[model samples]
Target: MRTILAAGALALALGASGIAFAEPVKVGMITTLSGGGAGLGVDARDGFMLAIKLSGSKDIEVVTEDDAMKPELAVQIADKMIQSDKVDVLTGIIWSNLAMAVVPNAVAQGKFYLSVNAGPSPLAGAKCDKNYFNVAYQNDNFHEAAGNYAQTEGIKKMFILAPNYPAGTDSLNGFKRYYKGELVGEVYTKLGQTDYAAEIAQIRASGADSVFFFLPGGMGIAFMKQYAQSGVGIPVMGPGFSFSQDVLAAIGDAALGAKNTASWSPDLDNPKNKEFVEAFKTEYNRLPSIYAAQAFDTGTLLAAAAAKADVKDADAFRAALAAAEFDSVRGKFKFNTNHHPIQDFYVREVVKNDEGVLTNKIVATSFTDHTDAYAAECKL
Candidate 1:
């Protein structure tokens, strides 16, 4: 009888603890893993998983899938994660189009969606949802920083280009919003186009004093190689995506001397950032890119919230996430009313480190405590 009474008392104590009996929070990660853009997604996934591993929390369970850079595939995976896997949160999209396809519906269905890389304007503006949060900069933020830098550099005539997609359009528009200069030419190429011969010919003939572009991944690599060989020499610049750590070595010395805008760099001086950079290099044997930093910040944000409230309690969890109590690697991170980050943007220049490897270093700050222009449009 004493044993039975003792067992009942222990059960009561366990039940009173609440979280001890709560199911682990499941996170669904759908990211590009097999395509031209794989490097971005792989770094994002690695950074996020590294944070989870470092936390040593068995209460967080992550399920990962490859989206293959396709919007349709991402949609199908998000639906399966919500209905079958019963994920408490969804994240790890690297492209803006895939985020547009997955984020709104997932959040509408009551699953919190945290962005690792993509931040489309519609989601930040008219279609803002309480459950949707963007840990990365808005798609236009970095481009706008480039524009500001160009003005500082006294480049009055510039040529600009990007792929013909939603993000591409946003990139040029953001540049124009801040440049306050004459555009000698503006061009949008096909998405994922590896050859930039004709574009280089056009750039050479444009008579622009400088050139700015927004090509990312393999596209940037191809363009930089071809442009270097063609001898355009117009002083190329762009957002950091065109010259991120994942693609820097591939770009080689052609990327040297080019200036780009980014929110984080390996040389950023902060305690949390220092730890993250060192730990990431030790874990992966490579430098972390801007995408990786954003993903790591997202994971840290989730961990802080999870520690404060159970995922099953929607209001409590949402409030805790809004509080954003984590020590972000970005130094100063806070969410706007639209749930997008408001942080500093810096101008980074590609330079060879002591080891002769291409890397970025902060040369100037373009904007401080920067808020997205579309934040006011968001009703939430």
Candidate 2:
């Protein structure tokens, strides 16, 4: 009896030792940082790095690449990250077109992809994969919120503006989903366009009382600056991306009172948001954009999952992340079946904070029990 018990104990000890020597977690973060889409990607990278630091993560090594907002480049970098670099998980994409390409490939490679933003529509639908998750709103979720708000504000005639691309179409469709208003015109701007004089002229010609747009990054600055000077007597509204802290600082007072909708804001009046805003300001010496907040939340959630999971293994970590319950800066974040988030969307007006930095102040939330339209696509 003593010999049998000793043999069992010895076997258990060897098994535990083998588990301890498994592997370190390798994370690949693919984003846009140097080319046409630098501004958004730079903020996302900084925010994600800051999150890694705050988590005091040592067991994980993250290697990053620049997709340059090019699909071919995205695929190339994803291949390197997956094959040569040996990443166990992937994260951080800033655009929907990029996400649509990057995420499916990552999942196909049998790796976990945690998105900080840019949830493509197809992922929420027919191509949904279990190895993926989004830490931000769907591609059209924010646009839909703006649409819903337009309906609430009694907007009758509207003109929609977006870049000529898949994301732009998604944004416009998202807006139209909730906005039961007459469409005066639907216009597409050049991607990364700065001069909005022609478009502003078109708006004046179209006679739109309410203008909805989906511009972001440097384009937002130029568009808003031009819109303010265009003498177009209309209320401009959209989601909080293109005109948040990063571009707001440059646009300054021009973006004041422009209404946008989003799931998180610095002035959300939540304990976690307040803490995040304060810490982010101190660390970066600027107001954090919603992109930064989303990246931070992604890190927090990942750390929580890793702490509770057998993270040295990929499948175990994915399961753990799916089951994670982290304290979100947005407050109470969780995943839906499609791995998209179920969160509130607030209507915020661009306002000057106490430090003279432009930020958003929440006016009203368009959704309380918001659910993305793509969950039924996912079998898991």
How far residue 294's Cα lies from its native spot in candidate 1, in Å, is: 0.6
Q: Write the per-residue lDDT of candidate 2 for residues 291-328, one digit (tens) a residue.
A: 88998888878777766665556677777787758878
Best by TM-score: 1
Q: State, as a TM-score between 0 and 1, how close model 1 is to the true structure.
A: 0.96
What Cα-based lDDT does every candidate model obtain?
0.92, 0.84
Off by over 4 Å in 1: 1-8, 15-22
- lDDT for model 1 comes to 0.92
Overlapping backbone residue pairs in candidate 2 total 1
Error (Å) of candidate 1 at residue 321 is 0.9
